[model samples]
Structure formats: C-alpha cells, structure tokens
Target chain A: MKRIILALAASSILTAGAASAETLKVCAEGAYPPFSKTNEAGDLEGFDIDIANAICDEIGVTCELQATEWDGIIPALLEKKCDAIIASMSITEERKKAIDFSEKYYNTPARFVARSDADFTIDEDGLADMVVGVQRGSVHQDFMEKTFPEVELQLYGTQDEVYLDLQSGRLDAAIQDSIAADDGFLKTDAGDGFAFIGGNQNDPAIHGEGAGIGVRKEDVFLKYALSAAIAALRENGTYKEINDKYFEFDIY
Target chain B: MRFELALQHWEVFASGVWMTLHLTALCLLIGGCIAIPVAFAMLRGGVSGWLATGYVYLFRGTPLLVQLYLVYYGLSQFDFIRETWFWRPPAYLRSACIEDLMGWKVCAADFIPSLRSAWWCALITFSLNSGAYVGEILRGALKNTPKGELEAATALGLTDKQVRRRIHIPSAFRRALPQYGNEVIFMMHGSAIMSVITLQDILGVGRWLRAKYYVPYEGIVASAILYLVITYLLVFAFQLIERRYLRHLNIKAPGAERGWFGRSAV
Candidate 1:
C-alpha cells in the first residue's frame, strides 16, 4: 500500500510537470543590481535574468521570472508560487535541509562597507556596535545577527534599501558580498560616500561560495538538469564571456 | 526547518503576539483618551469652525501610516529637539532625551528613515485618526439628543451647561453607544501598523522571525491568528459593553435578536 501511495504521488507530480511544460516559474528579488534589477521599462535585466532565460531555453521551457520580496522568496517557492528561484540565492547547509540547489554558477566573497569617512574595522568586536544594515533574507543577515550581536542590526528588503540606508544615515556600514558592494553599491556616487571596509567576520560561517539556482528538494531532476547546463555553459566559454561583462575576475 | 527549531523559537512568536496585544492596549488607552477631547473640540466648534474643520481635515485627510511617519520623523527636525535640547538640559535628563530623540536622529540623519522619533509619533497619529472617526460618532449621538428631552431640562430650570451635562449627554451617549463600540474596535485594528518602528510589537516580532527563519508561513500565520483572536475578543467586549450601557435605549432600540453577533464590525 505504501509503495502504491509513493508511486501515486510521484505520478501526480510528474503529471503536473508535464501539464506546465511550456512555462517555468522562477523567482528573483530584482533589487540587487548587475545581478538583477528592474530597468526603466520595468523589465527584469541583469546577469541572473539572462542566465535564467538561458537555462530555461536549454531545458526547453519558457521562463517567467517572478519578482518576489527577498524575505519571502524561499517560502514562496516551497508553496509552489513558483517552480524555482533564480534569485542570487546562496547554497548553504541550513538551506539544503529544506531545498535542493543547482551547481554553483557565480561566487563572490562577502565584504563589508561603511561611510568613506567612517573609521571601520573587523575583529572580536567588529561592527563599531553602530547601525549596520544587511539585506534581510541573505546569509549576511544570519551571519551578522549571530556573530555581532552588539552591532545594531537593520534589515532591508532589497539591496536598494541597504544602499539607500547606507547613503542616508540609517546605517553606519553594511556587510555584503564584495562584488555586489563594489559593482552594485560602491560603483554609484550615492554609494561613493562609502568604501569597502573589510571581509565578513562570518566568512567562515557563510558559504561565501558562488550563487546557485534554488529548486524544491523534491525536484531532483530539475536540479541535475540545471547543474548540467551550468557545467556546459562554463566549458563552452560562454560563462567567461558573460563574467567579463559583469566582473573584473571570475566569480566562481 | 525542523519542528525542533520552530519549537525552540516559539518564544519569539509568543512574545511577538504578546507585544502586539500590549501595543494595541496601550494605543487604545492613550489614543482613546486623546481622541475624546479632540472629538469634543470638533463637536463644540460649529461644523465650519476652525478647530473643528482642522481636526477633521488634517487627521482624516492623511493616511494613518503617513501621519505616524510625520510625527516620528518630523518632530526632531528642530535643533531644539536633538542637539540643542540635549545640551540645554541638565545632564541627568539626557538619557530620557536620548531615547525620545533616537528616531528623529535616524530620519534627520537618513535619506529616508522610518519616522520613529518618539512614542508621541504613534500617540499623536493614533489620537488624530481615532479622534476624527470618534468625532463623527459623537456628533451623530449629540444630534440624537431628543428635542423634548432638552426642553424638559430647561423646564426644570437647569442651565445650558447643566442640561448638556445631565440630560442631553446621558441620553445622547445612550443613543451613541452602538457606534462608539464600533469606533473602539476600529482603533484596536489600526494599531498593528505601529510595528514599523522600533516598537517591536507583535507584527515586528513576526517580521524579525520571518527574516531569521525564512519560514514566512509559520511566523506570519501565528501572528495572523493572534490578530484574529484579539479582534474576536475585542468584538465580544464591544457587544457586551453595548448591551450593558445601551440596554435602556431598547425603549427605541432594535430587538435583542438584531444584528448584534457581528464577527467583523471592525
């Protein structure tokens, strides 16, 4: 009876997948720039957006990038509001327990930033115990809340929120991935008031590994398919070609 | 993601719920008191009177959240409020000023900070919004002051103030009891938005939890359940208060079987 039940559930899921073959729902915050952001036309444009499209095309599926709030991104996927999340989400042990992740596509070390004028340092009591901002759903928030309890933690819904608060006086400094801080935040004049402080204290805690595609734990097939495509993209020189457009060095 | 983590973190959810209830109660007590005088002012001033018109136009015109932000962020803009006031005060009171001035410091300092200067921001916004609706309720009840009842007090040789105090106020309140119950419910519902600031009330707790665990469904559902329960209890309290106070108005009141079991008078 249990075997039959398991088989029945498998068949039902497979049937659902076949029923929606043309469309694949993927989630992205679209708030992190160079990775993803809404353009003037409100269209999703960035490295992740292009990668999501390429993966869907490789897998012979039409992709729809759903702009979900960062905080709710994982749960939104678990609830099947979308089939997968292509947001710049990281693969971590804690996250692995709940969901499966595709192969690493792009990697960046976590770094910290503060006002250009502010004297900042990282050690036993790293964050000057001042207001520190981080994008809420990412590993950075978890790392900060755990490692530096003294620092006043301010969470923003998006990268834009973090950058805005960094520019304004809401936060003393922000710790995030170096590439995002440099290409995304420090690249702008508003972010110009800021400079990279140092590497993350939780550098050991956060995977600091490249980002991966997020699919439900049950979607083993999708995970492997995506992983295979990422390997192909890397070997075909397409990955390096795209990486040069966004970064000075390989993110992986 | 384990049931054990959720169980371990239950306090976060529980305290969040408790704080939300705490915030609602405080806002209602503080906000309800302020609304009464404001409503009275609106009522006594003729409809076009300056105080009455401003009370209605200003509070009623602005969104509750916007009003809250303005109160929280706008107050500390004065040098008198933060730096100057801090220096002017005796050293002993700097602690008090520091707490009050923190929210203002952020918004004043930030490009777009949440208005969270002081409790006064929430207090003022809650009072203004609740007062407008409460004023409307008071106005309706005052208008319902029976014409014959007013004359009877006059025939008894009572002064205008005495008549207003004794006969008209009492009877009008009786007539207004049902609407007033509705107003209290509305105020309670509106207090949830106060969590946007440092007021780590239930909603804020839920937000903190969701951010931490990424378990939006569980924490949010828990908070929703609490809001629902509190809303339900509030509704029951209103019905009970209405029955006790306005029972006499049953002389002209609808039958007890009327629309009294409302689940969402809010």
Candidate 2:
C-alpha cells in the first residue's frame, strides 16, 4: 500500500509540474499600492499586475499573478517558487549582483510625508529629533539610515503600516516612494492631515535606476523575453492605456 | 562569501548582539515579575483569578507581532494619548540623582517620558506575552509543591507567611526553573521581531547588514550563530543556577558511568 501511494504521489507531482510549465508565474508584492495591491475582492489589480498581464499577452504565454511578501520575493524567485518577480523591485546595482532585472518599467522618486500642521524639514538637522518611519527592507530605509543616521527610524513590514503610524502621530514623518504615498495614503481619507514635506529625493545609489521585473541570474532567456515583451508593450500603446488607468503622468 | 562579508561587518553584529542581550534580559526580568503575581492570583481563585486567567488567555491567544502592533500603532490612534502628558519616571530618577551626576544625567529626563514610545511599546508587548507563558509554568510548579510539606509546616507551628516563604515559593521556583529557562530562550528568539520596529537588536543589525551589502546569507548566518551562542550561554547559566538552588534534590546515578550519549561503550 505504501509503495503504491508513493508512486501515485510521484505521478501527481509530475503532473502538477507539467501543468505549471506552460504558465508564466509572475510574483508581485500586492501590499504596495498603485504599483500592485489586493483589491476588496481579494484580486491583485494595479499598475504592475496590469503591466505583467500585458507582457504575458505580448509573449503569448498564460499569465499567473501571485501575491508574495516583498521581503521574500527575491528568495521565492531564487527558489523557483515563481519564474519571475514583477514586484516593483528597484533595479539597483546591489540587487543586480544577486538577480537579473529586465529593462526599466517605471521610475518613481522618493520623498518625506508629514502632517500639514507639523513644521519639520527633511534634512539631518531638521529631522534630528523627529521620529521617522520607513518600510523594512526598502531602498527608502537604506536612504534614511545612511542620510539621517541620528533620526529615530520606525520600520514597518509594509508600506501601509508606515502610513498608519504617520496618521496616528506616532511617527513624525515617513519616507517612501512618492507615487505610492500619493495614491496609497495621501489620496485616502486616513491621510487627511498629511502632505509631502520636501522636494523629491533621487540618489541613484539608494533609489537605483527604476523598478524592473526580477529574474534569476541563470534565467537569461526569461530575462530577455520579459525585456522584449516590456519594450513591445511600450511601443504598441498598451503600456499607455494601463498607465493612464492608474496615474496622470508617464511613469515609464 | 557569507562568512567574509559577516567578518567585514563585525561592528554591526556586535551592536546587534548587545541590543538583543539587553532587550531579552530586560523583558525576562520584567515578565518574571509580572508572572509571579499572576500565578498567585490564579491560585487564589475568584474574580481576580478570572481576571488573571483572562489576561493570560488574551496574551497567549494572540500573536506577539499583533500585540506589538496594537501597543505601538493601535494605542496611538487615540487623540487623548497623542496630545497629553503623564508623569515621567526617568525624569524623576534623573532629578533625584541630579546632584551626584553633575547634571550630566539631565539627558535621561526625556528617556522615559509620559508620551508613547516605540521602545516602551515593544518592551510592554514582549513582557505581557512572556508573562502569560511564564505564569502558566509557575502556576503548575506552585500547584505541584507537595501537600505533605504544607501539612508538616503547619504542624510545626509555622505561620502561613512562614510556610510560604520557607517552603512553597522556593520549591515552586526550583521546580519551574527548567521550563522557565526555556521561556527565557524563547523570549530571546522572539526579540528578533524588534527589528521590524527598527530597534536594532541582533536580528535587526543582521537585516541592516544584509540590506547594506545585498547579501542575505552573510547577515542571516552571522545572526544565527550569535543567537545560538547566546542561547547556549543562557542554558549554561540556567544549569549553574539549577545546580545551586536544587542541590538538595540531586541523586546519584543508577546507570553506567557517563560517556558520550550518557552511556559507557560496551
């Protein structure tokens, strides 16, 4: 009975692999809004997801959008849990050393947001006493750590959690991607008192080139395929249609 | 590759270790203090018993991470807390020691301010969580204190306080020490979650190092080794404490003389 069960399990596993072989597994951080987020209906619907589906359409492959925690997205790609990461992961030199990234899909600047009533500057001296919030394992965290070493940083697991702290006045300010702040927080009712405090921060060392789909270093073919599909989407006006649905200006 | 990177960032690891050690130690001490009273209340029975039971159940039922969020983020949602100030303990302490410390201690005035602080929030959440588990362990130990000893103490004309002080409490602690040691180790492991709140514990430092170097293995392995070392040291310390406190309960071995795996080679 044991031997028969083992053989059956093996066959089932093989069939499962075959089923997924033709499907293009695209992982995304569903918590990051405007880029990618889960809607009220428990479906992922956002710029990154739309863009990913468009790329799949261009490539003539069945697309599967999988929501993954941003922290584990790269590890998931490396482990073959997914074939590629369309998680709005910035194409930084540091990240490129580990995983391959396709051509830039979108570039968003970083900025600090605070309550409109509070008069705090975005500089080291200005932020010296203030408690700042940033998402853990994000480039903004790296930027804040390096730029404002003296400021008290409260790192949240998700970008939305940072807004929560900022809303409650627990955090004096929050540093994050500007577009994310605009669409995810500032535009919402919970962000009634908050406004962007400073000019956009754009240090390439931290912010990197832009967000790109991440593939494993060995998956050169998939990387090339994804890059081509992205380029085709831009040239064929599909990218613009999707872009207009989410944002006012060009994100590419 | 990971080891080389870890070695290069030794300072970060060291700082992380220091933070974890202090956070764990503080949490354990505070939690243990909270646990003892809760255990007593549980033993007493009635409304206080139910209250204590509810406290334990509430903490144990929820994830420590959620409890942390509730304290750090959820509690601050109220306007009363954000706009108000209460008595400050650190300020009072610094004021008391102002003359001796040459006013250099004035900086500590705001250390434990009345306002909500993320550090305090994390500490309180960890302590409450630890208190529940520790309380249950202690309650079990307290109940297991031999009834014969209590009867004998009463027969010897001992007062209730004397009986508890001389017999029950010490025996209960001695019995609970091993399980309590496990709780301490668990608390130490749980302290890694402090990284999410940006407190820079050993795990937090590891995270920072990984993000800075873009090498997860190096940071993760380095932190794991540090945690293992800390756990080993904690267990060793508990063993020493057990030996000292439970010396009277030790018995001679009935098995073969000690060797690898607690048995001599045939």
**Weakest 10 consecutive residues of candidate 2 chain B by summed lDDT:** B257-266
DockQ leader: 2
Indicate the residue-level lDDT of B98 in model 2: 41
- In model 2, the runs with Cα more than 4 Å from the true position are A1-21, A40-42, B86-106, B109-115, B253-266
| Displacement of the residue A250 alpha carbon in candidate 2, Å | 2.5
What do the candidate models score in CA lDDT, each in turn? 0.69, 0.79
What's the true lDDT of residue A91 in model 2? 89
Candidate 2's TM-score reads 0.85
> Which 10-residue window in model 2 chain A sums to the lowest lDDT?
A5-14
- Over A1-252, each residue of candidate 2 has an lDDT whose tens digit, in order, gives 323433343343235453254467788888888788899999998899999998877766667888886665676676677778998888888788779998889998998899988786778889988888888778888888788888988777688878887877778899888999999999989889889999999888978999999987876666677777788788989999999999999999
Chain B TM-scores across candidates? 0.74, 0.85
Supply candidate 2's per-residue lDDT for B47: 99
RMSD of each: 7.4, 8.2
